[model samples]
Target chain A: MKWTKRQRQPKLKEHIKEDPFVTDEALAALFEVSVQTIRLDRLEMNIPEVRERIKDVAQKQYDPVKALPEEEIIGEIVDLELDKYAISIMDIKKEHVFSRNSIARGHHIFAQANSLAVAVINDQLALTAHADISFKRQVSEGERVIAKAKVLEIGTLRTKVKIESFVEQSLVFEGMFSMFREEKKIKEE
Target chain B: MKWTKRQRQPKLKEHIKEDPFVTDEALAALFEVSVQTIRLDRLEMNIPEVRERIKDVAQKQYDPVKALPEEEIIGEIVDLELDKYAISIMDIKKEHVFSRNSIARGHHIFAQANSLAVAVINDQLALTAHADISFKRQVSEGERVIAKAKVLEIGTLRTKVKIESFVEQSLVFEGMFSMFREEKKIKEE
Candidate 1:
């Protein structure tokens, strides 16, 4: 029995399982094939596309509980959906405080909040489309940081969420994010 | 004259010239010294601290440019100012565009936009405090990206900037960044 490239493709899935975030180019290089060929293999293997993979990895890595290692919570989610939106509040850590220096790295905090916002959405998959953020105060590394998010609007194709991250009752970061929810289709009889 | 360990220390300016973006850990490892020792050297050299260094490097590396080879742009800006910022549209040939999987990696666009937003600020140094970004459309590998930025608000110690990145006329990404601009003080007579 002769094995064709198609017959050998399932093995790629195993490699992907080992590193789901690996790129098609890497796979192509490894298999001595073109990137388009590797992509075809990936599509056949039911692997999510690169964009999907990124959101998935970000969702896992930026899990609020994991991202905020030294912080404690103060508020609970009043509302959330499975479509990749969530909201929560926690005390800021002294070590997490912001100086001119720390604020410069503010994306960490925004990423965390945005990740949680996406996590609570009702869809099985969601990705950020856009965001507007306003920072009101400097937060200390160890100060208590309060976070809150709400679905401002949900459309048939898109969803908009608002998130607020605060420290010591002062608003440190306020954000509005537009998210794209991958809707599941129903087969019509 | 014999060179002692103290004399062997790279001149701060020369070290920065070698690679302004070199991490303290990398510098330490290269110089056969501890991270703390490298930091002290940086301090004595009037270089910003580690976090500051990261912010500076990240900002300068992320800015937008009118036109130039991506590599040349990246190379020209090396170590210009510890806190210098600039932005250039990411072309297809640049390494980070692919290495970071930006075309497929959803957040790389945001990362690049965020980095450029921080980089274009005028403070002798600035860092991203927080940013909210929206990805309007998926940018492809060969697309021409435009990163536009302007100061939204400038506080006594902190400044906010709004950055909108577009691919042609389409708004591909938009972000609002809060940065801590180091204010140089003028001594009173």
Candidate 2:
């Protein structure tokens, strides 16, 4: 419970690794140190902020995706709690639009939601079995689409996710996806 | 009906307008003229070939899509038979790729299938109720994806469409879409 700075730093690093989403304040309490000490320790260890840590964990944790590869996800997953909820962000760029109109292609929007649906499942193999989707409005280039997916139902072989994408305050797309998983078991953590 | 060149040209225009997908061979047989004559008539009247006509019709028709607008469909619909089948062609250009990898985005592919699924329905208002999809292979830029959608089942409120997309002979993507329509009524042509 009490250790010198030299001894605490290694344990702190391991703690953060085990729970990357752990906050500095939580780490301070766990390690019996000031929050400022945790921050200083993190700085010395080259650990990033909680937000960056979440992104890094999201990027590195999926082994790509439990369903596929990590690079296959359409957006940068900023927050993910597998089989519970996930949030991702995609900035519509020039490449994402129609050259003639500059309107963001609908698939880009769907992919973001679809991939999130897949990523949120706590399974080694997750695939979309069905999706009920709607394009609520047109998304143009230069907009940042923040997509949030929530697990609506979980079954032995299936899980359902509801994903809503927004460009700021306006809802741009919505989808409900039924996902197929290999089997029902607690994932090894 | 038999008619002079002057008479036939106007009739040909009318016929094409009536059925944009009508083949030259069919037109020749209907008009009792050689295929060459029909071609010549089309040439003189400034009407393009059937392939071009189909593209034009696919583009100009849909108002742009019965559910939304013409511009909403992801790819250019090359051939369509409302409620039966439809096809679209998308040449993956530079704009469709991630600048880092040049792989065509997943949404672009989905949009093509999703839009075709919407376009094939013979309803004034159709929306995707559900879709089961898979990415069979990674598609790169410069490849032309030919997507074909066929109606699998028709219900009073929902219709099922199976869409397969190919890069040459290799299957790149596939999806089964369950689409919802306003009601069971034949679209007035």
Measured against the true two-chain complex, the DockQ scores of the candidates, in the order shown, are: 0.18, 0.21
Stretches > 4 Å off in candidate 1: A1-85, A88-104, A184-189, B1-85, B88-108, B124-132, B139-171, B176-189
Candidate 1: tens digits of C-alpha lDDT, residues A12-67: 87777775545676677677778897777777777886446645654554434321
Please give the CA lDDT of all the candidate structures. 0.56, 0.78
Worst 10 residues of 1 chain A by lDDT: A65-74
lDDT of 1 by residue, B15-45 (tens): 7666444466666666777788877777776
lDDT of 2 at B66: 54
Error of 2 at B60 (Å): 14
Best by DockQ: 2
Error of 1 at A115 (Å): 0.6
Over B1-189, each residue of candidate 2 has an lDDT whose tens digit, in order, gives 588999888989999888665678778988999999999999898999876886776666533335546666778877777788888888899977655457676667888898889888876667666677776777888777889999989976579999999875679888888886765644321
lDDT of 2 by residue, A81-102 (tens): 8778888889899987755557
